[model samples]
Target: MVSRMFRIETGDDKDRRDLLRRRLLETNTAASPVLRALRGTPAERQRPLHLWVMDEADELAGGLVGHTWTTWLHVTYLWVDGRHRGTGLGSRLLAEAERAATERGCDAARLETWDFQAPDFYRGHGYRETGRTEGIPGGHQDVHFHKVLAG
Candidate 1:
């Protein structure tokens, strides 16, 4: 590839040309190691992973996981340790998840909780019941909730 340097600052042609040449050299050197490492590494595939852990007394209180896509954030899993129940940990976890979703540019967050799960907990946090499925031959059905983020 042919390399060329051009001045970018007004009225400082020589200095700008030198600066551009230095920048190009630095960029090429910075990327060479990564390129060489990936030459036999099968293209070095990667994916983004985010993890959050809540702890109490050195024990795991809860955790949440989600994946982001082009236009939406999908919540893959959420759990609060059984010993931490009734301690507001679940609500705090939900709030954290919502904050993360908003930060990731998601306009809304969605999740599902069983009938025997923390329905009231989610309701208290502004999540509204949008759907439900009953008569599953089990003791309880499933409920889904969603919250919209304000601009």
Candidate 2:
């Protein structure tokens, strides 16, 4: 057997990151038939992304971006402009996403929120905190929320 030392690259490199991600996915998929099957599902093969925006004066006010997968709508990002906060736009955006997800055969929605983010706002919209991890970044917490979509 031959032994060799490998050099490690440091700093932000999008190409390297993407290459690593591809390699890891390939390795995982090759090792497990279950993983391959899961990824080959009818719904998994189709990953459509959606972005709902709230615009004012040709400027961005708020938006909801997510993707519906199989049985869950993963809310990637939800942001409302500070001036537009508390105007129910956030709730409306969430409701709109949920509606789209339901139409796509999704039965639930899930998202992760930072401690400084609107976890309470999501809770008010029928999402419940399913998990929490503290000390994420300088005493901050990461909260996971999930909501069942209406059929």
Candidate 3:
């Protein structure tokens, strides 16, 4: 039997990261017919979707930040200032983002919120709990939610 020798190193390197990402994309595209078909299509790329609410003084109140890719809107963050919570601003922002995503041909939306966060708010907005990860920070659960957008 023959043995091989190689070095396994890890660090934050931009050029290496880019090369690795390109290689992985190529491999995935080659392995999956769906991904191969998406190459060079608009739906293949993730586009940012953000909505912001401002107060009368032009300060930030609440916002939603996420991206749309392949018929889905992934909401990464949604936050409202403590003074603005429970004022419906968050709902409005979320609604607007969903509208824009639907216009972009998305049929579904998803987001993750901690147990201490707005799981109930999402439920009230017609989202359903699809899964959960326990033992998150503060010993809480990370809840995942999904909603079928009104397209």
Best by TM-score: 3
For model 1, the superposed segments whose C-alpha errors exceed 4 Å read 1-51, 54-58
Candidate 1 residues 4-55, lDDT tens each?
Answer: 9776556658876767755764555457775334322211211222455557
Worst 10 residues of 3 by lDDT: 37-46
Once model 3 is optimally superposed onto the true structure by TM-score, how far is the C-alpha of residue 78 displaced, in angstroms?
0.3
Error of 3 at 85 (Å): 1.4
User: lDDT per residue, candidate 3, 81-147, as tens digits?
Assistant: 9999889888898999999999988899999999999999999999999999999977999999999
Arrange candidates, best TM-score first: 3, 2, 1
Error of 3 at 39 (Å): 6.6
TM-score of 1: 0.57
> What's the lDDT for all of these models?
0.64, 0.80, 0.88
Ordered from best to worst lDDT, the candidate numbers read 3, 2, 1
Backbone-clash count (model 2): 0
Give candidate 2 regions above 4 Å deviation.
Answer: 1-46
Error of 1 at 14 (Å): 54
